[model samples]
Target chain A: MSLARLSRSQQSNRLPELLVPAALGTLMLIYFAVPFVAFLTRAGTTNIITGLSTPEAQVAIRNSLLTAPISTLIATAFGVPLAYVLARASFVGKRLVEALVILPLIVPPVVGGAMILTAVGRFTPIGSAAATLGISLTDSLIGVILAQTFVAAPFVIITARAGFGAIDERLEQASRSLGYGPLSTFWNVSLPLARGAIIAGIILTFARAIGEFGATMMVAYNPRTMPTRIWVDFIAGGMDAIVPVALALLGITLAVLTAVQRFGRVPTVIDR
Target chain B: MILELKQLTHRYGDELAVDDVSFELEEGELLALLGPSGCGKTTIVQAIAGHVQPTAGRVVLRNRDVTEASPEDRHVGIVFQQPTLYPHMTVSENVAYGLTARGVEPNQRDERVSEYLELVDLTEQWDAYPSELSGGQQRRVEVARALAPQPDVLLLDEPLSALDRQLRERLRKEIARIQTETGVTTLFVTHDQQEAMALADRLIVMNDGRVSGSGTPRALYGSPPTPFVASFLGRSNTFPATVVAQQPPTLRVGTHKLTVSNQELSVSAGTSVTCHIRPDGLSVIAPGSENGTALSLAGEVVTVTDVGRRYDVTIRTERSDEFVVETVERPPEPGEEITLELPRDRITIFETHDHDRGSTTGVPEH
Candidate 1:
């Protein structure tokens, strides 16, 4: 054979080594993309607009939009401090605390709902105390928030802890040496350096909270969220009934992700 | 004294890291704590900065016992080994951080920041982020940031150890000039002896958690109290010898005899001792041109290395002992025999069994 044809034959012989991984990666990408593409194409824009105008769909949308952000705010305000403590301090039973923080991530969502019920059911001490104050703990919006918080709070804590852990301790020490105390140093140096991770954690927490269903079903089913409303519509009218809410959910999540990604692109501490 | 560390001892678990180390720095003086890595030079700096509380001792700054004080309360400025500029802030903002923490007004903080940036000659890069600057520029910003607060003292921990040789040399001169111009009482910690000798007004040599010697560069290099100090501070050749006589202080090294001055001899007759001679202290003499008072030996040239301004000529003497002589004169070729002269006043003798013997053999060739 000529030299060019001989090299081309050699290249053909070696192509399978590279082809296997490429083919497998394409298969996985198609598997993930096919469902979204099918759903969008099947549910036309006219059908989506009609399904979204119903009163039931409107209530579920309002409840989800309202409760998810409140739950996220609550998780962030408390979870960030806990993550900072876990990252920076050493004490007795610290491993136990860390395991407790990660328990929700490991346990099934329905089991976590049951665990929350055992601690705050209507018959329990805390639930009864709230009942005396004219607040029902179960079958209410508060119950929905409780369920969402239980399943979604861990994302923020774990991601933020990793962020705080990556900061160089010497930078904090430099701040302290320059006449700033620990608390001020945290506000000035530690928090700003860890902003990117914290924002990522917040996004993940909100996404998980809004999509939560199993735990919300176990606790509060009356004040329906988008996921619960979709379930109801599926049972009542099959695939045709649920398509519009699913599309709406996908649209909301995409918008939030895009907005946060734009805002969160500010340079992190170690980007350089 | 601007700062004093008394009986500073620290233990990490059961292992002692710093043992009864004590030193004092005068006002506006730059004192270098010099030693190899893991020798507790850094522990002393941490103790002084209040980052580390000694297991036992007092860290006194400006006559106040700061051992019990928090780092922020101590009002000390520190430049860590890394530049450690806040990556999120601009160069001026990083320099103004301390003043802001202390609640300095915006106008004054800006003025002070500019002044320090000017001092480090980084005024042109005031708005640049640390990542945009060169490594040397980043380090200069760190210096400016530490100095802007105008704390009572400044501590630099191996500030130039991470740079290349040319950059390090330039920064060394820059730091010396900065210390002189600002007159800040500074404690500099370093492992490189040349850096210590070049920048320190006075340096304390540490080895294995204790002070081996402490004095001016000239005093310590001229008369190192221990063999470790002798080798660590500069290049030297050591010979195992015994004092043969006390009158005129004679020493016998193998089969060769040498005489030293009375002031140089501390031990009596027949005491085992180590003799230290700097390479530059020895010179090659022509045949029949020897000075009568200086000790002389005949040796074969082993290697002649031209070190730019001078030649380092290695010689193997009749006793089979090797010595390196630095001279500007033309060097003899390998295997050529020549006579080397050792001046009496240049020899420093240490008792062989001194309590603080270090790991250095004081032989540069090996």
Candidate 2:
């Protein structure tokens, strides 16, 4: 009986109703695919080699690789524990905490960078305290790291929170009944269960940090990251200098994203 | 006592989840807390396991006042209704969870894990994850894991409630045998009376967040203390009666007179009460063939239902009361006359009272 229904539903295509939506979907695909195709079509090995030979471009690539990963690591260390807490604990200001964590996702990047500047710029009380500890937050690599961390931390929090929330509470209770304390249970059961989501979050944070523009432009532009360098190159030379560096950044993003998507294929309960 | 609950009163705002409930368990005793939902049976189990702290009283385990202890410190194993096997862990690892938590040597953990898995007859499935097993198989895994630690007490919260009928019946017997072999003081919570009666050494029948009745299966079944007990364990034929005589202990039930044993009737003459007769107490005979030895009711067979091994013949008496007689013999056809003989010794009496859910209808149709 279900087979009959399945075949009937399959037979009824609703082609007339789907035509407009299908056209719109194709239009969107074309819209997204065109620019990337144009960039790739214009580039060659010689241009990439030349772009790589430039000292300023090399420094920018090095700077982005260094700071983006640091931001991602810092985001992970803070966000994962916060996500687990948000998933499991019932605190007085839980909703407020969640809204604050999601602040970077909705607020404009330049605005977030400006807020960070006012709070921890070179002359601010906390900023000088940080400088006294050898950590700078304006026109420096540390400034780039802080801005990227602020903008990208929410990605980790939101994704990891979902992952942690999917786990059954019984699993933790079972661990407790089996004589494990809450901290140990979190390490052994909760962490392993949320491994996939954490990796995915890390990938997204790294990508966002690497490609950061408005915030990095606000906090620090001297020790230029990849995005700032690309902007500089685009202004000085035309699309020629922008092309090769952009492709390099795109390459790194693709590698990490692909690795995350492949490596984070966690065996879900359904796989059991 | 291996376990003791002393005046445990757990409240939720103004409502009582467990109101001054107390009980004691001897070593190796399999006690069942049987009740409908919201009856505090699960609360008592949780309190003993240290998952829930009672608002007022203490839970003593092995003579130790472990009221403020954590679940880890209490060393109690729990098996939930939905078998809570760690899905990521294989069966053997799941069984060895408690031992590993205690930092037991790997060699001993493996041996004990295999032993308990074999105990639940799931040795071959040790390499399988929880979701890979069937409902009954998963339940067996849970039982194995709960037993592996060899805890002082085992708490099962409606463990067999989720299985299909056949699986529940088979696992019921399996759990009883396992409990006997392990000899762990087990306090199992269930809403199913039949399952409770079959598995428990003694049953604690709960109602409204307190113990309403408690006794051995035979004792509670033979002499239910209230209307709830009388019907909960199995079906009972109840009749509203007023005491007519105190000296010889007789009751005027409607127009009929029933002579009950004096000890079963505690109320004075002219006081109203409820008389309970087990369905087995009614013996059907051909009409007008009954002797003067027992109370007789002349009735016509209303329905004859073939219930596998026997037939349930429902007879409607002339007084408009219906009684069901379970018999293996050939039952009379519908509309045929029969005599229902009520044996006086099997009758139980209770003070007239109103049940929250049940009707005041003298006879409840089950």
Candidate 3:
């Protein structure tokens, strides 16, 4: 039989086999799409614009805008090196280190915040020292940052680790043999090769940090983030007040995602 | 000597990978490490490149001990088996990487990159990434990259084995030309005997982690010191034989007797020895042809394989010993009885207990 005819006949024979999965997949897609559609329709542009004009909403927007990027920067600056080490080096307790890196992701965000508090609470030595230096570790922007970093840093580390792991070690070896030192080889070969994945991880970290709620609430409730503000709005004024702030939060997140998608085209080494 | 590995040994945990391997490369000499897969040839290359620290022994370059030095400090250029051209870099950038790392002026680096790219005939591909090139083209880029640094010694770890037969042959010639033009001391590692023999000035045959033999390609091919070298180097018909006479130097292969040169027969009479004869060494004597000083064996044609450029005829003798004979002329069919002639000088004999034997019959796949 001709190839086209054979393929068509085979596809037709498999249609019944695909029916269940296709139906299930479409249902799940709709389930995910429904909330976004409902939120967008209910929180009209006028409501969103008006809600975002409120003093509380403005403060929350300012706090989120300021903290998330800083948190993302911190995560990328520290996490990429950790990821590289985990991927390339073998040392004692390496498995434990890897598991610890993923601990923030595994634990509940409130529990993570509580763990952060127990370690650096006002009564603790680090918190008391910071307080004595006139810097409060909790109930401030620093607290918000700590919470967001705790909740979101794992995304970048895990993704960047996977990216570094995919690189051929021989490429680095080749770099070294060509007279580049280990550090130079890492900068010249490893970093550029894993840039695609690291950028992807950065995007995910920023998204998660911006949307972080439970941990942010547990650590710093006064200097409100978008999620915390939404929670307060839901408690005080119900759905009507919550919609605009929620839409504002969604709008900022979507804008960030869109901007990143447009600009940060992840460059990867072409597979041989 | 440009580079010397003295009694180099490396072990991966409890398993030994390279065992007391020692060799030297004279200035601008092309040496090939020929061996089978997992024979630790690549490990030796790594040791020389300073990528792997040898468990014991020193690597001396230009009379300077460099065994403890890092790869970057060694200034040894290497082309890996896989074309490890930095996929993220353009051809020009890849070629200039080493020079840039060495802090050469940008203008000088560009000049050297263009020079080496042109040497590999990839000047037109300077702007292209490695992924845009063919396998052979990528390998050429790797060679250009390795050569642009002007390293004291160049190590190629089976650089062309990944290509097809036609491309491999073409690149092999190009590599030889490039090496000659650069005049850099080079060590080429390969499992294919043909590639080794065709490219190298001298060959080091390795087996299981040790050097079985080392000599000029022609010398190694004609007179391998060990049975592993004989079977691994080229096509050979090896027979388990016993030395029957000392003065005339004769071996008894089953019921047939074959005489060899006295130079290779160091064992005494009645000692067990392995007889090795290349396919081309044995000939089919026509029924009425004169067999002057050539040992003759009467056998039946078992199989004839028409390999390109020649025909390999497998003949089973009356004593059930099989020997393959290669000839340009068409051979008789299977079951046809024939008389095969063995020239005395073409035979090489080794004491059976001297070294471990590889395959006793049939050609090894490359």
Query: Model 2: per-residue lDDT, tens digit, A1-272?
Result: 57656765787865554568889999999999998787788885337978877998899999999999999999999999999999989889988999999889898999999998999998999999999999887999999999999999999888888889989877777788889998998888898887887787888788999999988889998799999999999999888879878988999888877766677774331221
Give me candidate 2's interface root-mean-square deviation. Answer: 1.2
Share of native C-alpha contacts between chains A and B (below 8 angstroms) recovered by candidate 3: 0.89
**Local distance difference test, per candidate?**
0.87, 0.85, 0.87
List chain A TM-scores, every candidate, in order.
Answer: 0.88, 0.88, 0.90
Off by over 4 Å in 3: A1-23, A267-272, B244-250, B253-259, B264-268, B286-292, B354-356, B364-366
Span of ten consecutive residues with least summed lDDT in model 2 chain B: B357-366
| Residue A10 lDDT in candidate 3 | 79
Residues B1-366 of candidate 1 have per-residue lDDT tens digits of 888899999998898999999999889999999998999988888888888889999999999999999899987889888769999999999999999888899979888988999999999998999999999999999998988888889999999999999999999999999999999999899999989998999989998899999999999999888888988887777767899987888898776688776455667898998878888899887657877777788888999999889899888888877888888988888888888888878888887666667644453432
> Which stretches in model 2 have alpha-carbon errors above 4 Å?
A1-30, A44-46, A132-134, A260-272, B12-15, B245-249, B262-266, B285-287, B298-302, B315-322, B333-339, B352-366
lDDT of 3 by residue, B1-366 (tens): 899989999999999999888999999999999998999999999998888999999999999999999999997999998768888889999998889888899978888888999999989998999999989999999998998889999999999888899999999999999989999999999999999999999999998899999999999989778788888877888767788888777778667677676565667888887777888899886655745687677889999998888898999887677899989997898988888887878777878555446776745545
TM-score of chain B of 1: 0.92
CA lDDT, candidate 2, residue B100: 89
- Candidate 1: list runs displaced more than 4 Å: A1-24, A266-272, B244-250, B256-259, B262-270, B286-292, B352-356, B359-366
Worst 10 residues of 2 chain A by lDDT: A263-272
Best by TM-score: 3
What is the RMSD of candidate 3? 3.5
Residue A147 in model 3: shift from native, Å?
A: 1.3
Best by DockQ: 3
DockQ of each: 0.73, 0.63, 0.78
